[model samples]
Target: MAKGVISAADQAEQLKQDGNTYFKKNRLGAAIDAYTEAITLCPNIPVYWTNRALCHLKRNDWTRVEEDCLKAVQLDNKSVKGHYMLGLALLQKEKYAEGIKELQRALDLGRGAHPNSYMVEEIWQELATAKYQEWERDSTKRSWELRRLKESCETALEEKYSRDDVSQKTDDTDEISNSTSEQLAALKLVFDKAAEADTPTDVPDYLCCKITLDIFRDPVITPSGLTYERAVILDHLEKVGKFDPITRETLFASQLIPNLAIKEAVEAFLEKHGWAYKMD
Candidate 1:
């Protein structure tokens, strides 16, 4: 090796460092240029592509973000940043199915690598949002189909008896009407039962404390970012162990923070569904 010549890998490392500096300063264009040069020098390095994709994401350049993240994931399939950025880009383009798929992958990988990390929480939140949106859209479609079916049934019934005999049709009409009502009542019972099964009768999982498996009266957050009832957690801290039960991570009484958001959520839920209070 020549004394004055720098290796391509070394040069790429230097460029990557420069890109990090530029990104920290919010100089996205310069950061992207540096990352691009690093990527050119070491195309197999997933970090460079992922870094550049982040810059594109900030600029709302969904197409470019998608391209860079795809390249990054191809280089390393387990790249969390690659899948996360690609999911965000696909979501921006309203590709819900593909976006949710990528986000789910990112969540799985991030959770495995860093169970209590903020990145894993972010992935979970995004995946949950995507799933909810997809469910809502599908629900709307199902509602429309049900309405159409009802309309079609009414139209068919009206057409069937439109030209029946005036005298004899009266008895026949009454019998058919009774039979149709019975059939419709049976169908309604089936639908009502299905709806009851689908509707949640218990407290939401978020509102319940993991330790007590009951709705939180006073929620507090731990350093691990999990919420639990204040009294239960304090009791656990005193008697059980100095660790988060769910994450098995070291915890201290001083590290507990008031989870005001969750507290407010529980209050609102109880206000809307007062019967939940008796759901023992």
Candidate 2:
């Protein structure tokens, strides 16, 4: 047995470790190269595609992120990262309805089988954004449809009564014809609530980070008793120095603690909008 017989899997694992080292050092290009080599050597490994996708995500390359994530999920449907990154990429492409599905699937799979609570919180935030976008889209569509219907009804009524025989329209028909917009408005109100088939955009200000003006992916409470997004606060501390932006109280990165209540509230919101949890 000579010493020159390393299996392809072993070689791939070595490349994967190298990629992780590069990733930690923030050398995303090198990390992607290493992951690409590993994927070439072991195309069946879902992690390899996910690793490359994450590197792409770091660079904000949504198209490549989408491609690699799709590949990972194709290999292993249970890959949480695969679904999550795909969701992010899709969201970037403004495919909110589809992105919401992938994100919810990532959370569901991550909770029971993978169980990364931190990642789950981020997924919920992403899911909320996706659902909000989806709601906006549906809202716009419903408005357009309602207007179209109202115009159509008005046109039909005018044509029917404009005839020399205005008497053909009874009192009941005249009343109905004049109430087109009103009837449509009532119908729209009912369907608007129902159309929240996904998440509602009326999220409370308390649930959002003042800095980002968005819901927190990782809410952390500062010593000043104010909560902010974790990554956002960390960046602020690094670049702007440690201080509560709102309270102007001196702060330290180490003083931040996980705000579990907010995380749970976000999760509950997503649960209520379960219809947004599947790709259309």
Candidate 3:
């Protein structure tokens, strides 16, 4: 009986090795079957769980991938592959915040020794993309709010001027005219300052570009390149400036604006160029 048991254990070990070979060949279904058989023969082995997790990942069975990864981690909390697999599985589910935390934990646990730099970089890139997307959404909301505020201010000014004109017909002529002129002067000053503030300052264009690129290159927040995010921000700023009366002309024609001042430059360019934009 003991001899038979020992022979069965040896067979299970052979089956596990065969599963690994199949996995290496990208024969995921066959690898899964072999790993499953090995687990039945020796359910205590952590290798079986780990190998099965790899097959599940290749098949894009994220739930099973997560299950097997947790099992492996339970068996050996120190397993770097276990934590990495969990993070990848969570990321695929679009649970970005949780996925980032898990990936960061994997890195903190000294998983850098693993020969998977490309995979690690991909994970980091995903996290960065999520963060940048969040930021873009927030910026959009603020732009809309600023547009509404400008419209409200304009409406209030119009209402106040209309009231003053009606009152001027019934009040002292000289006093009412002087008051109207003083108010108009103050309003003109405010409008002039707003227009002047729309253009970019003296910062170098290249420096602005470099700073924007660096923001997108951050491993934790912006893993991907800056092209996509930068384009989106520029496009949005252009739209906002065009629709915003106070900022429209001032943003379009400024020669001193830096190319890297993407937001401010777009506003200035739109204002200077009479808010004309090609949709293509």
Of candidate 2, the 10-residue stretch with the lowest lDDT total is: 271-280
Order of candidate numbers by lDDT, starting with the best: 1, 2, 3
- Clash pairs for candidate 1: none
Off by over 4 Å in 3: 4-9, 110-280
Better of 1 and 2 by TM-score: 1
Q: What's the count of clashing pairs in each model shown?
A: 0, 0, 13
**Which 10-residue window in model 1 sums to the lowest lDDT?**
271-280
Residue 166 displacement (Å), model 1: 3.9
Best by TM-score: 1
Candidate 2 TM-score, true structure as reference: 0.58
Better of 1 and 3 by TM-score: 1
Q: Which TM-score value belongs to model 1? A: 0.69
Predicted model with the maximum lDDT: 1
Candidate 3 least-lDDT 10 residues: 216-225
Model 3 TM:
0.49
Task: List per-prediction Cα lDDT, in the order shown.
Answer: 0.81, 0.80, 0.59
User: Candidate 2, residues 63-171: lDDT per residue as tens digits?
Assistant: 9999999999999998999999999999898888788889989988887774436787678767766776676677667767766776686566556545523665565
